[model samples]
Target: MPYQQHTAKKMARPTGNVRWMVVGLCFLGMVINYIDRANLGVALPGMAHDLSLTPFEQGLALSAFFYAYAAFQFFGGGLADKFGPRAMYTFSSLWWGALTAATAFASSMLSLFGVRFLLGAGEAGAYPSCATAVGRWFPKHERALATAIYDNGSRVGGALSLPLVILIVETMGWRESFIITGILGLLFAVLWIKFYRDPRLHPTLNAEELTYIEQGGARPIDPATEEKISWLSLFKFRAVWGLMLGSFSLNFIAYFFITWMPSYLINELHFSLVKVGFVGMLPPLTAVFGGLFGGWLGDHLVRRGVSLSVARKIVICIGMLAGSSIALAVFVPSGAWAMALLCLSYSGIAFCASNSGSLCLDIAPTGRHVAAIMGIQNGSANLAGIIMPVVVGLLVGNENNFSHALMLIGVFGFIGAFSFIVIVGKIAPLTRAKRVKVADAGANNEITH
Candidate 1:
């Protein structure tokens, strides 16, 4: 069926308590998800020193989570579709938390790798489920902003992880730091189970509000319909492949900085731990503002009559180009200038991620089927997490340096930018043929239009 035209009636936005309630919960979930992951990188220097790990071995450990995470993306989405976001969210949160705490018990590389891998498997559902919730709860115009608001968790997690990890590692031990971070996740899991309700199932949701969300293009698909959409069928489409490759390329750049920046500051630039902890937050701090700004700009462009395709692709391309180019600053003589460039580069990706993920929803044939699509995209992207750490390990091993690693990432960024422009094509629903053969039950009959 064709989309019904909106008759010039603009619905009023939800006022007061309800709006705040939803945003607050989502924001907390985002924070919990990122903070747990960020702690590992922050604590890595100490963990490495204590364990006597080589750069190659350290990279292997860092990439361990992604090994399982990338594999579980599809499974996570299936679980979300089968059990609903509430159950998936609650279970994943608790499961990852438990795995994170288990890291404290590790005395060897194998133990740490095992725990991290489990953590990844448990947390695989995080972003896709969050995207599903946004699809269920927000209007189309508001999703970018809502996504940006929640995505600040990455910044917050990265920012907070530095100081918190430093403090905990200093006061207690690196092991305690892992345990503390893990326990925080457990608390969030309990809260999620208690608070989240599917919008249709919530008696408090008003008709006017439902109509507003629905009119703005939110599709309240039956929970059952989520399962009816086959994950393998979604994978067969060219667009799905585009999202997968694009997301993986983007993560190749992103996870590098996320997983390695603090160590880079210490080893390459000769920064003190105190300085690393304090100054490291500046990039993510800038990223928070960049994401918010990018979200607002992308949505504004759409409202001004630009197609969603053009708006998303332009923002993402500009951000990737800027990010990749700024990486060249590593060659400059001044360390301060290099750090500033690094900051600007990640800020660009921050902006891009804020808007780009929402494109999955915009182009998904039905909002109901978005989880599986997002799952594949996320899974493919996370494969980069596995590949990046291992590659960085190879490039920056004991005798080698970062020059080749930096160049490789720059090339990837360039390729990723081209992909959005050339390969992504228009942001519209995919067409499938409507024609089907008509058969007579008893005898052969001519079909007429």
Candidate 2:
């Protein structure tokens, strides 16, 4: 389809960085989104004490969110595709924000579990919606950087939550922390609804900017002529399955930080809550740079004439291998050494994550399918979120030793490296075979349709 002609006044040259503005919104949304999710982990100790819950039960609370979250990813992608990112994002943020505040009211395990499950459902749409927006707004060359900018929220939010949530919990109480974060999300939802729009439909976009985006391969709004692929058809590709497995492995290691790291630091290393507030932030803070670097490295490799396949796979493998260092933390003698190893592991996971997200856009068959494919990969990957917390709880039963759990996460990082290297194929859009139809004529003859 041809680029949508701008009837409004044209600029001599592209003047506004509107695309970057969209990326900035996505980044802010991610930051708010993660703060809400990670707040639970940071506040878990106090919550558990208040509720009289055991470690296994605490794991269950964490896992509950991922159950609905995992289930909704594909569906959320479809919604983003059908409804557009602006609406989907607004709805998701509002839904999760309300639920995050409601979490403060939980009186029992069942109530907390129910609230978290619903919170998961509300938050599930965020990443897929952002993926859809990025695929549509940015060119192929800029996607990794754009994705990294937004994806970095996961680390930044996680990093911020350590001290921020701890401070809130320490001063205002855990219940109030939820209320505060939820309000931030609600405010962001308002901002997103007011400011976001499709680039073609954006009033502030200049002709030159639009042309530059189109010429550089930004996917325009879906045209009548574009062929639509069914969501289920995505499963037939081997790369899809490979991405699923690879992401699952990555998340297995990554979720440990989100769900269990605080406990490990406090219970095993004997760090005070105040100490954890300052010290615990280091690993994820390191990851902020790692993700940015990974995005730059992939884009740099492509600019230098490396094959997309070689470039993406190289970064992914290197990240997972570096992440495997988490196991080494168990052998380190001091808390400082252990923190360094964990930082290496978390940073490696963040490095791999930037490109892993880009792979969704890389392999999507069309612009329409970008979010659907993202949902599929993310849906599968988040199963680790559901399983890891419970597994760690069981492994750390009574002893509070995280050695076994650390080794397990390390092993999965190696497995993630293997999946990327061996299971995933060439980094390119998938093609589906066209279907032929037949028409029956009075049960006597059949003709191609």
User: What is the per-residue lDDT of model 2 for residues 1-449, given as tens digits with 9 covering 90 to 100?
Assistant: 43232222231335768998998899899888888999999999999999998999999999999999999986998888788899999999999899999988998999999999999999988998899888888766677888888998888888898888898888899999999989988999999999999888899988778776766556555567456667886775667788889999999999988899999999999999999888898998999899999988987787666777898888899999989999998999999999999999999998988888899888777778888888888998999999999999999987888889899989999899988777776677666442121122211111122
Itemize residue pairs with steric clashes in candidate 1.
none
Find the candidate with the highest lDDT and give its number: 2
Summarize candidate 1's per-residue lDDT along 135-237 as a digit string, tens digits: 7777666667777777777777888888888999999999999899899889988998888887777667787776666676664565443333355656545
Model 2: residues >4 Å from true position, as ranges? 2-15, 433-449
On TM-score, the candidate that comes out on top is 2
In order, candidate lDDTs are 0.75, 0.85
Query: On a 0 to 1 TM-score scale, where does candidate 2 land against the true structure?
Result: 0.93
Model 2: lowest-lDDT 10 consecutive positions: 437-446
Worst lDDT window (10 residues) for model 1? 434-443
| Model 1 misplaced stretches (Cα beyond 4 Å) | 1-9, 16-20, 223-229, 434-449
| Residue 190, candidate 1: C-alpha displacement in angstroms | 1.4
lDDT of 2: 0.85
Model 1 has an lDDT value of 0.75
